[model samples]
Target: MNIVDIIIKKKNKQELSYDELSFAFNSYLKKNIPDYQMSALLMAITINGMTMKETINLTDVFIKSGEVYKFNKKVCDKHSTGGIGDTVTFIIAPIVAALKIPMAKMSGRGLGYTGGTIDKLESIPGYKVELSKEEFYNQFNKIGLVISSQTDKLVPLDKVIYSLRDITGTTESLPLIASSIMSKKIAAGATYIVIDIKYGTGAFIKTKEEANEFSEMLNKIANHFKRKIRTIITPMDNPLSSCIGNALEVIEAMEVLKGKKSPLKEVSLEVAAHIISMAKDISVKEAKELCEEVLNKKEAYKMFEKWIITQGGDLSKIKVSDKIITLKSSVSGTISSINALNCGKLAVKLGAGRLTKESQIDYGVGIKLLKREGSKVKKGDVLAELYVNDLDIKLTDEDLKLFTIK
Candidate 1:
């Protein structure tokens, strides 16, 4: 019944019962248990890990801590574990929506190198990220898609626990991380969920093996809630899209919706096809062709424009900063690699991203890649450009080393 008992049990590597896990999380939510006690329990969990049952129990309690949205129509949603330049949601949601699939999503802001879906959407002028429940449902009913900010009343305990983990150096615990993400998705009341799990330098999971493990864990947890989930593991050694900033990322997504041929377009279509396949129960090939059809015919673009206007976003005024610096190739050769993690860190340094939740982001500032992998460049050829509010943005030797030419 007491937090101390649970903490001590976990500290001794003993498996806590469902009631024990429930009592700990509920007590923490009710403020009956101090943060110090929770911190101790988290550390114990980090060191001694949790069984699948324990992890699911923790996730259940977290979901029960807040409101679970129920939609009148069949609900489908997509989530990404996050990666540099991840704007796939903008594409997939619209693609599925254009297919008459109900897509209701809740997203968050960027904290480090990973781009937040809400941040990219907010870069559009007049876009309303905070929509009331009625407005959200209305948008879904009207256009079959709606994206909004995560409500505090939904899985609030994840917020508190995540903040604590941020400072306690326990953020790397797989069980904790999986539970935090799955809890929100489960609470969102989506019957079908598509998740993008990225791993590499710029992703949370640094290896494909780790990504697979996390994906399995995530699916198991989702199954506990009886939600059908699909997970994709992608590489993040370089930015997922061609752009790595707020407004710039939106511009890239707009290009994709307009049927422009780019890397972003390619990856987004793949992810969207998966969503379409699940939502419509069609073959992957059929889903892919349909997704491309929507893009080529500009149906998804229309949906995107309508969604933006419905949410109060202005498409016309979205612009990147005028302060741009083009970095040229010092030597001519093929670009063998680009370090996404370094580029993301540089973006954060240049005010394109946030160091913490409280940090303000300059939506106008970001990096754009002019050339990608296997591209041969001549000396003095433009490789990338930097957009910044401050003209004094400095690039370090390490930053310059991010691009490797062979």
Candidate 2:
């Protein structure tokens, strides 16, 4: 039952039984195990990976490490591996929530190259991200959508383990990633879940084959839990939106909420529609129409407003400054391609993201791309604009690499 022995067993690629895993987690929670030994065990698990039995055991271990809130009503959510500009969650949840499909979303802080939902909402003046179990259940009972931050006490072990995974070069493994995500969702009591699996230049899984493999594994795991899971593979070759940072993405989500016509706006609504349809078992067209009604009729915008207020975000006087730092075209020609990774890097440089999990982000500092794939541009056209809360960070040649106009 001791962790070192379990670590030694797993390091040798031996399967750890469910009881052993559960006892290890229980010991960790009780402060009987030091992080170094636990980390050794984690790294061992990463290198050897986990067997299906072990994966299920790990799932159970993390699922019970903290309080799991269950609802009698069916609840669902969607998760994406960090991508360059994927802002689908901001738009998707509200639409599905409006449809009376309970969207009990619990999100984390942004990591590495991707933005986080809590960060985006915090850009609003008075948004609240943490809700008590009572508050969460009450809100879900009322509006059917309760998007909140993962509470400090919920799946605490997963939070710590996931951070270590990011730092230890263990993020690329499919079983680890799948288990990390599913554990949180399982702990959150999502009866049904939709995973938006993406692969391209901009996403974590850069090949379609990799994406599909992970998608199938996720489907298999969800089925094991008797939870309905739907997955869709999308392209992240380009940033999913014109906006990639916190407040800037929030601005784009606002436009979709307000029924504005833009590619980011369109795609946001499009994904939201699919999530709604999949959760409710309706046609995409019907779902899109229902979502469109919420947007076009201003209900979606209102719901976002409510969500902001509910999460303790300030809405009044929340304006994304359009007065921007335009990084223009070097020469006029076809755009040929844009590198999602480079753009994400520049976003981090511009203060939109963090290199370390501990770094802070400027919600205002990000680019809104005006041009996308297959576009011809004139020299000096504003290709992208940097929104900065601080006027000091110098935008340099390295920051402008993928933005080549030739």
Candidate 3:
């Protein structure tokens, strides 16, 4: 019953029962279990790995640690496992909601290079990211869409364990990753869930093989919980969209919703189609057609505006910094690639993201790609623009190395 025995049992690669997992987690939450012991157990779990049963048990433990939200109407949700310039949520939520599908999403904040939906939303002035239980339900009932930050009362244990795992070098463990992600999605009460698993130099999963394995594990957990799920594996060697900051990305999403053709629009539509297919019991092809219809007719944009207004977000208040540094091509050639990881890091330096949890985000600062991969450019042609409010934030030659032109 003690935490020591549970830690020892897990360290030996033995399966932990639900009671044992729950006891350890609740004890940790209550300050009975020190972080060092929890870190040891997490490392053991990462190296030894957990069986499907253990993962499910741990996920259940996370869910039981806090309140699980319930909605009067069936709701859908989508999650992207961290990526650079991945602004699909902004486009997907409104598109699905425009089709009469309710989407209830709980997003996180930017921590490292990857952008977060909550942070992106908060870039808009007066946008409320934290909502009470009553406000959440009322918003869902009123607009059929609610995107907010995770509250302390919802899957609070995941927050504690996630922070520990982040620093303990156990963040890459498959079972731990599955349990953490599924726990939050499940606790948020989404009847249907769509997950975008990105893999490449810029994503957490480094290869297609690992992404597939993670996908299988996620599917197993979804099946066990009887939640309809779809997982999309996408490459992330290049940024998903041309925008790489908070307000800038939001602007790009609005452009896509307004029927602009870009990589962001393609990925967003595919993800939205899958969610619609599951929620409405239609084929993905049919769902895609519906999505295009909505976008072409500007229905999605209308919904985006309504959702923003309902959530108290002011579009006019979203201002990108006027201090711009244009990055130009040095040689006349086509763009071979845009290093997603490097772009993210450069954006972080521009204050588009946070170096730490408490780091302040400069909502107006970010990068805008003027030309994407495969575009031909002449010498001196503008490649990208860096937006900054800080006079000292200057781009170096190394920063220009993000775009590989030949």
Candidate 4:
């Protein structure tokens, strides 16, 4: 039962049984297993990979490490693997809740290139993220919606393991990624989980093949645990929405709910449709139609305003940067492409994203895409706008690389 033996077995590409993996995690949490040894095993698992059983076992270990919430209705939890300008969660929660679906979501904050739902929500002044369990249940029961922080009691071991993975350079391991994500969802007590798997330069996964593989693994593991899961693989060739900052994204979400049509609306509707279809046992087509109806009638938007009020978020107090700069197109042709990753990096540079976990972000800072992929742009047409806290934030040639024209 020594941790070294488990490490060696995984390092040699051998499957560690449920007990072995469970003991390892429990021991790690108890401080019986040191990080260097655990890190070595994580790296080994990253390179050598894990079998389906091992992946499931690992997920089970994480799930058993914490408390699971119980609700009267089946909780419909939607999670995105995350990408630049990803503000789908805000729209989906209200839309589905407007249709009477119960959505109790526990969201994380932004870390690197991707923006998080909680971070976006917190951009609103006086918004409270840490809700009491009573508050969480009351909101869900009364309004059919609740989105809050993941408490220390829910999958607490994941914090330690994930932190180790963050610094050990082993975050890309498929099994680890799948188990890490699925474990949280499982522990959260969601009856149905919808996964938004984005792939491309702007996403965590880089290719369709890789995204598919990740989705398949997630599905397989979900089935093993007897939990239901659905995945939507979308292209992140461009940002999901025109807005890429905390406050900016919340503003964009509000605009979408108000019936302004954009790429964000299109993708958010699609994801919401899946959630409704799965939770209600209706066809995805019908679910999409319902989502649209809710948005078009302004029902979802009203729900959003109500949800914000209930959660103590003050929209009027959300700040927007006064120093604005517009980057216009130098030449005209249909926009050939918008490099998603570079665009994300540009937002990070503009003080919209964090360089480290502890880094502070200017909620008012972000980028707006005036000319998206395939849009017609004449010379001098405004391509994008940078909302920055500092006046000296300049766009470089590398920044221009985000916009490619024919």
Q: For residues 1-406, could you state the per-residue lDDT of candidate 1 as single tens digits?
A: 7788888999999999988988888788788888889999999999999999888988988898998888766788888888888888888778888888888888877745677788888899999998776787788888778899867788888878876765566766778888888887778778888888888988877998988888889999988788888998888888888889989989988888987787778888888888888878999899999988888899999999988998899999998999988888899899999889888888888887766546787899989999998899999999999998977867787776668999
Per-residue lDDT of candidate 3, residues 129-213 (tens digit): 9998789888999999999987889988887887676556776788988998899889999999999999997777779999999
CA lDDT, candidate 3, residue 239: 93
Task: TM-score for candidate 4, please give it.
Answer: 0.92
Q: Report the number of clashing residue pairs per model.
A: 0, 12, 0, 0
Most lDDT-accurate candidate = 3
| Model 2 TM-score, 2 decimals | 0.89
**Could you give the candidate ranking by lDDT, starting with the highest?**
3, 4, 1, 2
Window of ten residues with lowest summed lDDT in model 1: 163-172
Q: Which residue pairs show collisions in model 4?
A: none
Query: For residues 6-96, could you state the per-residue lDDT of candidate 2 as single tens digits?
Result: 9899889998898988877677767788767777877887678777767766777887788898999778888877787777787777777
lDDT of 4: 0.86
Give the lowest summed-lDDT range of ten residues in model 2. 315-324
Q: For residues 1-406, what per-residue lDDT tens digits would candidate 4 score against the true structure?
A: 8988988998888999999999988889888988888888899999999998899889989888988778766889999988989999989999999998888888877645787778788899988888777787888888888888777778778767866775567767889878878888888778999999998988878899999999999999889878899999999988889888999999988988998888889899899999999998999999999998999899999999999999899988988798898888899899988888888888888888777545677888988888888898899999988898877766678875778988
lDDT of each: 0.84, 0.77, 0.89, 0.86
